[model samples]
Target: MIYLQLFWEFFKTGLFAVGGGMATLPFLQAIGESTGWYTYTDLMNMLAVSESTPGPIGINMATYVGFTAAGIPGAVVATIGEVTPSIIVILIVAAVLHSFRNNPYVDHAFYGLRPASTGLIGAACAAVVLEVLTSIQLVAQEGGILKTAALTLDAAAPLGGVLNLRGVALAAVLLVLTNWVPKVKGLHPIVFIGLSAVVGVVFGFAGV
Candidate 1:
């Protein structure tokens, strides 16, 4: 029953998360909240792991969640569930794409989808940024303009601090190296990833 539920949940995710992998973050968050299979922190870790590893982020996340929830069989089922919708959609699209290639309605539909997907991906990025750079538990507290204004004024306040210093520093260094330093900018992403891993380990050991 649990396996079937997992399959159905991820099938829905794949069916509707029209953009790329990051666009699935919202659905994944909803799934986490609804199922209690994982927490937001777990999702952040999953995102990091998925981004760093091979294959698509969404599929990797589904596999990780499934494995964590059940076992090897769960991983297989979840992964299959995630990809099944894409497979079906692609088959249908391939069959009818030629006919719709010049259809204005289809083109207009895709045009609207572009912005919608962008919005979803942008929201996902914001969520990740908040998770990485701020205290999500504190941020979730009830309040509106006043709370936001207070946080803006007292960024380093005891509750809901402005930034994760370590994460910010790492991000700054990576940005500079990747964008400004000519030599580093030319290197493969894997090189910088390895450096980031080493830095993370050092910081972890230092209790940063």
Candidate 2:
């Protein structure tokens, strides 16, 4: 029953999360809230680990979440569920794409999808930024995104409780290294991700 639930949830995610891996964040969040399987912190950690290692983020996340929920079999079922839709859709698209390649409606549909994809990805980015740079765990505790968001807007909130200074510092440093530093700017992103992992380990052990 749990396995079936995992498959159904990921199947829905894969079917409707139209843009790409990053675009699935919103659905992933919804799944976490609905299932009580993981928390927002868990999702962020999943994103970090998924993006840092191997294949598509969505599939990786599905595997991780499934494993966490029901071990090995759940992982397999969830992964298959996540990819099944893509395989089916690709088959359908391939069979008819040649016929529709020049159709005005098809072109317009693709054009329309671009903005929707951008918006989904943008929302995901905002959510990540909020999680990392701000202490918005109230949403995790109470499941009130609107309430926590409103709290963030309060000018009189205590600084120490509102901002994650270490996260802010790390993000600032990474941004500078990636965008401004001549020697570092050209390095592949995986290099930073690896370094960040090492730093995270150190922070963890040091109780920071």
Write down the TM-score of every candidate: 0.57, 0.58
lDDT (C-alpha) at residue 176 in model 2: 97
The numbered model that scores best in lDDT is: 2
Q: Tell me which residue pairs clash in candidate 1.
A: none
Poorly placed runs, candidate 1 (over 4 Å): 1-58, 64-74, 94-98, 108-116, 136-160, 205-208
Candidate 1 yields a Cα-based lDDT of 0.81
Which lDDT tens digits does candidate 2 get at residues 29-65?
9988999999999989988899778888878988888
Compared to the true structure, candidate 2 yields what TM-score? Answer: 0.58
In model 2, how large is the Cα lDDT of residue 45? 96
Quantify all predictions' global Cα lDDT against the true fold. Answer: 0.81, 0.82
Best by TM-score: 2
lDDT of model 2 at position 90: 98
Error of 1 at 182 (Å): 2.1
Lowest summed-lDDT stretch of 10 residues in model 2?
Answer: 149-158
